[model samples]
Target: MPTTATPYLLRSNTGKNSLKGALDSLIASHINQLGPSMLVQVEAVTASAASLTGKVTVRPMVQQQDALSRPLPHDIIHNVPYLRIQGGSSALIIDPKPGDIGFIIISGRDHTHAVTTRKPAPPASFRQFSMQDCVYVGGFLNNGPDQFIQATDHGWRIVTPGSVTIEASHIEANCDITTSGDVRAGGISLKQHVHGGVQTGAGASAPPQ
Candidate 1:
């Protein structure tokens, strides 16, 4: 009969290794808790022109599991900050809407201290890698947009399927103009309008001085 090795032999697998490996293994056991980055879906968005950043309530796209391997509840996270591309008074705000998917990057420490002040400060709490410390930066789209303003190596293009309204005091154009619709100036239609004393005839007119 062959003698069998006891649980003591298993100790060699971890005990014989370097302390770094052992510590890393211990942390790995709680990998799910160490939030880094995750894909999420935007639930609700709240923003204002007066605020510096927008907040979103999101739901994690990938479900999490508990220690017992049971599926954890998909909770709705609230008061998560979001990113926007802006500088001073020039801002290109791409506000997120419900049903839009996005991503969130989790901070290693508690970061609620800057919520009201909008300035950097020391970590307020000891919580590390919690879901509460995340920022949403919106994500993949399911379809193309009906209206968009895009700039690329080729050129800049603006497309709109609906009407547009512009409020400006003055305007200037340096390029050739083309029009499929009638051009109007001071309530005068160029396509279908007649000047004073002008008749439909082949008569030449003198140049105005």
Candidate 2:
């Protein structure tokens, strides 16, 4: 009768008097208690239409010390999740790759599991702009140099030190137009034109001699 607060001795599955044996024994004895969440190492990954299946080895916690004399037990658990694949949300598709470490949580008595993949370390080319209340994706240009779109409380905003060019088949606007630069409609007829703070209609003509 081992209480939750009681420290139990771990024994290996092979009955060997080694650290590995002790950790294995500890995991075996507390497998049920280790749920409904456990850290797992992804050995293989298979993608289906809706979900991702991972052949993961569960790392069970044991009351023992590591090789460096650290009081942490690292044990490998085989055949975890019972070959079940967990699907992600429709908005986000999760594709877990091999060697991806993650966690699996048992969600139901019938052994339905929920898996979440951990993010890997970013590469040297990856860049990000982070602030106290704002975050922007930097080092990525769109249409011009030094351009970045930032997410704000109001909405998304594109910032650039240079000019911006937008190409679209059609454009629609529901608000008034304001700009410091000149607005030109290429190869299109104009109904009126404003020059030198004076509006000229299409019916206006040049003076005759």
Candidate 3:
């Protein structure tokens, strides 16, 4: 197991003490140094719905090899940035809970300046591809969600065993509903309770006052 005192690459240098052997070992060790991504188990997450800013505490699921090739646990990383999926007027809010497993992508160089400025900036630190610099992206759970919203090219679908609630100042939808798309609960139509402005269409019921 690689520890703070042991250099991971030098652990397996039992081949020879020659300079050539040393160079070969050094070259081989470089492969493990460039971290593009790593599987991590979420220890905890702190999220702010208002600002949509937060950090994650995670532990690397994969261990580094020591000279003896024994598995060692990585120290739990704290205050790593969380990647929030968002755009101009919309954002997907998915906060990870403890015990959830996910992945963290590593940047080629330090990105503290970029993250702080929310723009492209020079690396603030000399660190390259270090585990200390990672962005958490959740949803790599071993289990699945009971409720899900799926969208396809043809249609959008929301499925859940529990009640689905939509809170808005106004609700409006346009659809071909001669045989479908009516408001219903327990197979009973709630169209009668709905207020007006429904356009007349084939098999469309008149909007009642």
Candidate 4:
């Protein structure tokens, strides 16, 4: 019978070589290619006060690696256009600040070359209704007053957890007004009048005194 090679011999030679080859292939496949489109983190931003367009400097978070598995320094992309989403009644413009992460795609050529960046993630705590185009949150929005509109076990509610005040030049309601609490108004005028705290029907005779 032919002599079989020992397990140690197989591991020392063929097994180690095959493992190395597989690892190299996997790393190569996963490596990021140097190109126009890349995932990047914004290093700094310069917004234009005059227009929605602005410039942003970014560093590539995804980068290619050298043969020895060392990461190579990527070129810092600068003056990339902070683009706005067009074709809507209102444009959605993005102004990226420092530490914001996004993806960028370089387009055009020569003098007209431009880089477009967009933030891929939303704020950590936010609830969006895409169909209604509305958003609700637990925190303050856009330096405005805190107002909570949320759904409860019973139904939906628009609530101000503290004392509430409404100020307007004029307030009008097209439908009938109903309230559970006492309502005090400044000289309320109604098409139908109320006498002695009771609303009387039109053309109805008063009860005997």
Number of the top TM-score candidate? 1
Candidate 3 residue pairs in clash (backbone atoms < 3 Å): none
Scored by lDDT, model 1 comes in at: 0.80
Decide which is better by TM-score, 2 or 4.
Answer: 4
Candidate 4's TM-score reads 0.38
Pairs clashing within candidate 4: none
**lDDT by candidate, in order shown:** 0.80, 0.44, 0.78, 0.53
Task: Give the alpha carbon lDDT tens digit for every residue of 81-109 in model 1.
Answer: 88888888777777888888888898989
| lDDT, model 4, position 24 | 60
Better of 3 and 4 by lDDT: 3
Any runs in candidate 1 off by more than 4 Å, and if so which? 1-12, 15-24, 48-52, 67-70, 151-154, 199-209
Counted clashes in each candidate structure:
0, 4, 0, 0
- Worst 10 contiguous positions by lDDT, candidate 1: 7-16
Name the candidate, 1 or 2, with the larger TM-score value. Answer: 1
Report the C-alpha lDDT of model 2 over 1-209, residue by residue, as the tens digit: 86565333432234577667777778886763433444445554444644444333444333356568778654554444323323454333344444545555443332212222333333222222211111111111213335567789998887878887666998898989776655556633243443343346756544221
Which residue pairs collide, candidate 1? none
C-alpha root-mean-square deviation, candidate 1? 6.5
lDDT of 4 by residue, 56-144 (tens): 77777777688899988778776666555556456544455676666665422222211222344333333222111111111111333
Ranked by lDDT from best down, the candidates are 1, 3, 4, 2
lDDT of 3 by residue, 1-209 (tens): 75577665566556678655777888888976887687898898788665747888999998977899999898998888887678876777767778888899888898888877879898998999888778888767558777789888988877899886676898776965554556666555766565455666656655544
What's each prediction's TM-score?
0.75, 0.28, 0.66, 0.38
